[model samples]
Target: MGRHSRKGPKSSGPDIEAATADAGADREAVRPVPGTGRRRRSVEAPAGSDGHTPFQQTGHVRGGHPEQREPGGGWGTGLQQLHRGDDHRPGARPTAQQQAAAGRQQSTGTRPLVPGPRREFVDAFDAPPAPPAPPAPRGPSIPPPRPADPSTSVGERDEQPPGGGTDGPAPAKDGKGAKGRTFTGIAAAAVTTVLAVVVAGQVTQDNGGGTTSAQPSGVDRLGPDGASRSDDRPTPEPVRAKPLSYAQKMAKAYPLAPELKASGKFEAVPGTAKAPGRGHRYRYRIDVEKGLGLDAALFARAVQETLNDDRSWAHDGAMTFERVSTDDPDFVITLASPGTTGEWCMKSGLDTTEDNVSCDSAATERVMINAYRWAQGSSTFGPDKLFAYRQMLINHEVGHRLGHDHVSCGTRGALAPVMQQQTKSLNIDGIKCRPNAWVYPPS
Candidate 1:
């Protein structure tokens, strides 16, 4: 069988050699197209059985050729010989060096022995090239254009409510017509027209005035300064008022007991100030009684607490309440009912004695104020006024003790000196003094 198979392919020799030579010639003749700069794949011999005999050779078109061959004994046949190098023989094992080299190649992402490029004959007769992509269409340039304006009138342009509108004062209405329909329409129109005329006139006047030089109101030029022009009106020397220290400021506000320096009391120990006897160093003995007279005591306590809590008052060491007493105490704090008498007092009636009856700065050195009249709303003045009066009276008597005399209201809206009799009536009589309206020196 082997002998017959070997001999069987002798007739196919000339044809196979001719095919092989043709394939080689085809490869040698292959060339790249001009300007493409790309090389074509070349054709090469197809390995097979029959020991490379030219007589056993075969030929095929690039894409249409069958891939398999017949078994061992025939020309260009035998699948076993076709894939000879790819399969392992029985129990063949890789050498240590070979295995190590393969592992190294894998680790480094590299390999050897890739097949050479296709032969020239294959390149010349390979599959047709892929179709080229289509070209893009050309378009015209469009330059940006101006925005379309809807209307010419500024009012219409801005979509404002009619006639040459403005944000300021409303146009006055014409009072010439009656109060109904046509009157309103006509009046509105007339008013709008008048406003238009006035506005036009003002604009024209302004434009005209810009052309003329007006007389300078000062030694300086009417134009902006820096031209070295002097003003006839005394350039009031910019008297930058010296800023008072926090203490000075508080003292200026409540001069009776100028702001005191902070004692270590509040900060000494956490609860030290609030401690029973230790904290109660300043005992506030409120003289509670029936009648309007006692009301002053309550109000005084409120004032006392307000002053105590006042950060400004506390931080400054000018004064601190050791204790609050009613009468014959270090500081006698007396009160005035709806009707009370004596030198130090607060009442609607005009009475001045050893225990005065009006809320005023008496020469005496103890505090007297109205409690009932101030609370019951029947005071001749407002609570604020009564408060001020009471405050003044108290501070004033204290002032006498401190050696201060009667002083007037010097500031425009500043808190008036405790000695001042700023209230119209000694008692609350007219518009109550607003709490927020403090007295200050007139500018």
Candidate 2:
């Protein structure tokens, strides 16, 4: 009996022998299979026994080798042999048979064999060739051309390179084309900025002063020192008239007849003069009757100066007087014609028509100063004494307003009281007295 006689019945005689021979040859041709612990043994036919092979009862195919059988023994074992057949040396080329086997495996929808470790083979016939290196530049390298402006029409865009090739517009030499446009844009902006600054400066100059001067008018051709002047020289200030001095105001006589009747309408002198000292202050307004031909400003000035004099009612800081135009004043000192003065004084039951004199209208806010007495001097205090006479008149009338009454000189020849009706006469009951203009007359 054969060595397999104890194992199983041998079914097919010739087929089993042929399959056993092929399986033995395959085991010798390759390394051991990865997972299987034992190798396949050859099954011999039993001598003088039935013809069925024992492997047939084990489900092994009759004519096929174990590697060619289904599943567990056939296809899986074939794949392992394919992997083992590859040469695993570094950089070794794959054999033509190996590549053909891999292609065949792929074509059959089988997984392609993975090469073993340390084997790195590339199929030269299948891999693409390496690209050639770019050519060196002929001369100086040029910068790439700038993109065409989207705003430009196709015809206006840069022409193609010579020979009509699809190369970009020819590169600019030294990048001067792009640099020139950049420089031009910068220059234009700088010029625009300068112009804007110039215009703004001109506008500021014009607005600084209330008026604009194309060329300076009324300019002096020469300076005060007689040097020749250029047109660019600063314009000269206007020539203003010098203000009148106190003596000049005093010396000037205004024209108004003693009996001249004026329009009774009066206007308050427009200004304010603050009292000069810390004293009991009395605020007063000065009003001049219209058409009196008097210098109202001069009269207002005289009243302020006189009342504030050290010898007058404001003596020794005992009292102060402020002249105002707008506020409610303690009293309004009015310079009016004799008719207006007499009319105002009559309201207080004082008959001033007999002497055409000024009076304090006790019944009203006005303290009237006769324009005739103010403009023309009285016979008692003649024209040469006009300045003193005017002062006396103002003091006497204002004194009455301050609650003083008529009084006369007691001595043979003494300065009359400022409250005296000095305009009528400097004498009372046959005794003559000198003129006085202040309550506290100078010693």
Candidate 3:
């Protein structure tokens, strides 16, 4: 018997992948034309056979119709003849249709395609469908470009409202118009009142000095040496220093931790002398902590400016202020850090740290201002009125030096007195007063 075949369940042929690796795998793969069911497969030789025959080759145009092939394994069309067999170059083999056409060409010597340029070859059997026409031309080139906007000479265009009125706000309802006119009148009146108050308080055309009264017009009693003698003038009424308000706890502590100078020395501010008759000219000194980071000059100027204002200590024409650097100044206003304030103002008996209040240390003769309070105004006086708060702080502490007593809010919503202990609550008499920096009303 012939050899009993034991190579059971054998593959019909070698996969295209194995044959692909045998060739340089870098070559492009061979594939049938799209839409063509024709397959180019491998027909391996029998297992027992020697692998040397051309039939030992891997993939080929298999299952070709005998009629499609030429009479003797030749081409049937004018396609270029394929590399006969086992050429290692990939993609060199003809497609099945090309192979069939080559066979026909070998049989008949005539070429089906005449190689010529400049002409499209659309095969009805394989060409794709025709393209669509381009979109219709967009409508008449819109807007035709406004005639160069009538040149700049057209003066400024009055931008009319959508309602077609001339340059003005759109017309409102009748009721709205009436209300708007009323509001405008009220606003104008309010503005006039405010202007009057501010003018009176700060200055008036009547008095060159902001105060209602100016320095008493007594001739300067010059000494025999020509210096004005101070002893000749009557002593002015002393401004008592005891502004009062409730001792309210701080609902919240100040948030800033500023850098301050620890230097114990004091620096005096520079300014001009007060004119005679404004009142008894009082000399004062201003100093800041050595490393206290604050602009000492600016702070001193603010204090000086505040005190010299018509609405301030000098407002009543009873006293005028002169910033001095004398060894024995009437008073030394010290901007002190919280810690320093505690030491210098310990006798004041206020918590320098948590109380956040400045003190006029009667014993030390120093107006010790808590730098924290200086930087951050109190809760009673919100930040919006920061400048006013600063002014009030200066006035209140200096009021202490001037012997002023604490005073409660005299009337609800009225401006609190400068001498009020307003760093605390102003509502001692169930009347919440607005924060005020000036002792006297607007001139």
Best by TM-score: 2
Worst 10 residues of 3 by lDDT: 65-74
RMSD to native, candidate 2: 29.1
Q: Give one clash count per candidate, in the order shown.
A: 47, 8, 30
Which of the two, 1 or 3, has more TM-score? 3
Assess every candidate by TM-score.
Answer: 0.26, 0.45, 0.42
User: Considering only N, C-alpha and C atoms within 3 Å, which residue pairs clash in candidate 2?
Assistant: 10-52, 10-53, 10-54, 11-51, 11-52, 11-53, 12-52, 12-53
Query: What C-alpha RMSD separates each model from the true structure?
Result: 35.3, 29.1, 35.6
- Candidate 3 local lDDT, 1-443, one digit each (tens): 11222221222243322433433343433321111223443322234453222211223322211111121121122332223352222211233454344334424544335323212223432578778989978532222223322211122112211222222223344557557756766776776787778778676645445434444687665667887888767889999977432112112233446434366655555553443336888877877776566667667777777788778778768788777766677888888887788778877665555565788888876899888887778778886666777878888888888998888877888888888888888787688988787877674
- Candidate 2 achieves a global lDDT of 0.66
lDDT of 2 by residue, 233-299 (tens): 7898999999988767765567888788899899999999999867899999999999988788889
The parts of candidate 1 lying over 4 Å away from their true place are: 1-285, 288-290, 293-297, 306-315, 324-328, 343-366, 376-397, 411-415, 425-443
TM-score result, candidate 1: 0.26
Q: Where is model 2 more than 4 Å wrong at Cα? A: 1-244
Among all windows of 10 consecutive residues in model 1, the one with the lowest summed lDDT is: 264-273
